[model samples]
Target: MTRCLRRIAPLALALCHLAAATPAAAQESAAAEALFDRGLADMEAGKYETGCASIAESHRIEPKPGALFTLAICESRWGRVASAFTRFGDYLALYEQMTPDQKSRQGERAKVARKERDRLGPLVPELSLSLPPGAPAGTVVKRDGRAVDGALLGKGVPVEPGEHVVSTQAPGGPVWETRIQLAEGEKKRVALQVNGASTAAPSGGISGRRTAAFVAGGVGVAGLVLGGVTGALTLGKKSVVEEHCGSAIGVSDETACDQTGIDAAESASTTGLVSTIGFGLGLAGLGAAAVLFLTEPKQGEEAAAATSRRIRARVLAAGPDGVVIGARGAW
Candidate 1:
């Protein structure tokens, strides 16, 4: 019992001191005053939206109806009547709790303040939030370094300066986001961008490449034609020479004609051999060019060059195209 008492006694004493040290109501009022001023400052700076939020918070903590009315009025030029009506009810309740002297002072203050503040009540065009395209679905958009959830798409209402965030989500779609800063009375369109796959390939790409291959094959055929022409010419020249040589030998002894026939026949045979080789080689070269054009840039080239290059994600379902490849990476 003594041991338990010792532990409990210190805790009790600490609790008493803590309560004595903290004046909850006074502290709350002080915080409300500070928040109220912050909202006013934001308003002056053209951050009406942020000002509205701050002022609303101040009134919530201290039940300051005048402050709440001023907030509702200035936040959207008094357009938030629903909020003002709600706050007014609470304000009157708190007003009833005040002493006679407090009530008198507030009434006098209200007369002067309301006259002036009335004109400024209701900030025109309430502020709202939004996101952009290409953002991942279900990802939050950031503004001023803070994340905002459920930012709607399209242009949002003007915001107070400093920063704001828009949160976004799209089922089976790219997440979208956008950040914006607004000054008082500033209006602007916020665009939302989303990212996703392209549905169709570009035109005349593979087709053009295939056309080139056909053109190359045609050149190869031309080479064959050249070979045939040369071969035919050689054969024709040699046949003519043989006929002349045979005729000359039978009719008369002519050494010069015989020598001419022999030379012509040998020249034609050499021509045929050269033409055949050239035709074969040209066809091979054309084949090689076609292969190079049809193939993708090699993996080696991809690995070596990684600076701001275009990247694609593809899933192959079957056969040679259906392989999963991974890269070694460092972050």
Candidate 2:
């Protein structure tokens, strides 16, 4: 009896601890569900802006495939076809992990996503990039300031219809750059030249430090935007909680608070954290941008560099007896 009690006691204690944790988890789940319901209602009422915001908040509170699917649908309905397409791709990635029954349940959504992708596929613009023959072995290419993956080089890459800048650089080579505009269903090929060793360098070129500062600044700006959106969501959730479980409602302590209130408060805290992060990033970005700009050379050097490349033409004529050389310069 003593031995049996020792083993059973541990099991009983473990079960008790598990049971104690259940209420908190259940409460959080309930809160997320309430937010989801509100979002759904708003979406149905065609208050899309608020509805989408609420939906995004709900997803943040508790990421789920269903919420993602709904968000995709909302984007599609709003005529954000490109955004919807991206969301649909994300949904499909998540859906692949479901069981057979779960997959069946989401079959209709999958069909809709496929249909949309196919319909939009033909209308999407693409860019085909290539480097000139005998380019430096390690030349790197970028589109819109982002590096192209090695596998994507010399292949057709899908892009939104718009103007795009393509640039390339290699060790011991000058930067080659060009800009192109693409319309829907258009495919344009761009070739990059690897400047020979003898080519003149651009005056006061952008330094590595300046480039790093610029990238950091961009990231910081993104973080700030995230913080702002999350902060607003936190405020919204807090208001909801206060309405349902304020001090006037005899819920002085969080433990005694309504489940909805608890969930909202938690969400608010999360968003506040995100907001703090965003502001931090934004400040950092501005600071880096300033410092980099200050340390980099002025516009006069760049103008001079531009002027150096503006030569007119050189003509060489070989006649029956002799050769004559003539040159024209931009006065």
Candidate 3:
């Protein structure tokens, strides 16, 4: 009795395991069938994207011949001719491996798959890529973000008709990339080259600070000349006032002044005010020019220098009384 029980123990355990697995397998099949039905309904309603997604998931869960054929049809109708062609080929291959009874049941679908595959063969687009002579070894070429087989280079490989991005990069080199659009049955050849050198910065011109410095210096010189000319005229007018009014050189008593003396004094005041304004402008302009020239940026430090130093100088107001020079800066 013990010997008999030992012999039967393994068999019973196997049966128990099989019975336990059966429900899970049945649930998966049921889920796959539901997804397949939903996919068909969605496709009928002209929702190809979602339909294809559901069908693909169904096929992944249970790779049934009917589901594969239906998925191929959905892909074809959705404009993915290459994917449909590949799926149809897969279905036909699966049909070849089916038992006689299975083959009999799938015979008509197999015929349709073969016919569609053949029809799409000539309509699919092809892409051929190549590298220039003397291209570096280990240069990787990619299409649509996936690496392309080196053996496929220079060979016309079938692809789906649409836009594709082709890029090539060598080790430690800049990536060279291009975009290509292909129509049905069109064949295109692309030659890729690695760009080893980086783009260079722009070449020489006058720096902004130097230009501003030159302008300020010019303004300063002009102001100094105006101040000198006006100063001399003021001295001549004061002499006239002193001579006509019998006033001392530095005296300000204008009560005894004649018309000539009053006019001379008024002219002197005008020239004197102008002199003061010109001198003020000259000093401010020269100081600004000096600061700008001294704080000019060195090579490769232009941006840092700009942020570090900011100086502005201008004339605020000028009139008979006096002139105002305004200067603001940060170091």
In the order shown, the candidates' Cα RMSDs to the true structure are 14.1, 37.5, 13.3
The lDDT of each candidate is 0.56, 0.72, 0.83
Candidate 1, 1-331: lDDT as tens digits: 9999998999999999889877976799999999999989888787877888888899889865578556745644434433543444445556678788888867654444444344333332334544432244465454446554464434454344434454344546554455555553455565444344221122112433355556656766776677677878878877767676755568564434566687787787787776775566455545534553443244345334344344322222212112222222232
Candidate 2: pairs in clash: none
- Tens-place lDDT per residue, model 2, 26-115, is 887787788888888988888777777777788887888888888877766665555667777888888888899999887588777777
Q: Evaluate residue 153 in candidate 2 and report its C-alpha lDDT on the 0 to 100 scale.
A: 76
What does candidate 3's lDDT look like per residue over 1-331, in tens digits? 9999999999999999999999999999999999999999998888999999999999999988899999999989988888999999999888889899989987589888888999998889999998775467788899999999999999998898999999988878888899999999899998776676322123345666778888988888888889899999999998887777744534466556777888988998888888887876776677778877776766676667568867666566765455566667798
What C-alpha lDDT does candidate 1 achieve relative to the native structure? 0.56
- The TM-score that candidate 3 achieves is 0.57
- Candidate 2 vs candidate 3: the TM-score winner is 3
